[model samples]
Target: MNPAEPLPRAGYADVRIIAASPDIARRVADVLRRCFDSTEQRSYPAGHDGGTRLQLTVDTAHPAGPARSWLAASQPQRADRPQGSEA
Candidate 1:
């Protein structure tokens, strides 16, 4: 199947995780699976380099956990930062 083909259902998205090794690629995909319902990942060679690419379809409408939890927890509070300072 063509990787560029559109997903069959609404709220479904195609995702590709690329890394230097298969284990690293799979670890990133696993993080997404924790946040959303996803299909089995397909592995592929990224290029002439020894990199790995993994592709899968995730259901955005059906989140396995709070999608924004990690983001929210990691962001610093506005009051804790110096006013008018550039990040």
Candidate 2:
């Protein structure tokens, strides 16, 4: 399979494993976490539920070595206007 290939799962937006190594995966994850700060339930609806709900995978099995990076399939959900409704 190619790096451009999609993951083997259902109901996902986009998923891809780019790195190849636990160290690299950790590095990448750190970078992503820093970059994608506020991507968790704690930062969500202010004591409501979840946040940037995304799913990712880090592979750890290869001839060369363990795989790194993550593949995720997710979709974002935002609220709309509540007309003629109680708050």
Which candidate achieves the best lDDT against the true structure? Answer: 1
Tell me the TM-score of model 1: 0.69
Per-residue lDDT tens digits for candidate 2, residues 1-87, read: 479876644332232223433445445555544433222211112123321322343222211112122322232333674556645
Residue runs of model 2 more than 4 Å from their true location after superposition: 1-15, 38-87
- Model 1 C-alpha lDDT per residue in residues 1-87, reported as the tens digit of each score: 488865568988889888999999999998999998899999999988999989999987776656757646776788767767555
Error of 2 at 51 (Å): 30
TM-score between model 2 and native: 0.25
Worst 10 residues of 1 by lDDT: 63-72
Clashes of each: 0, 2
Query: Total clashes, candidate 1?
Result: 0
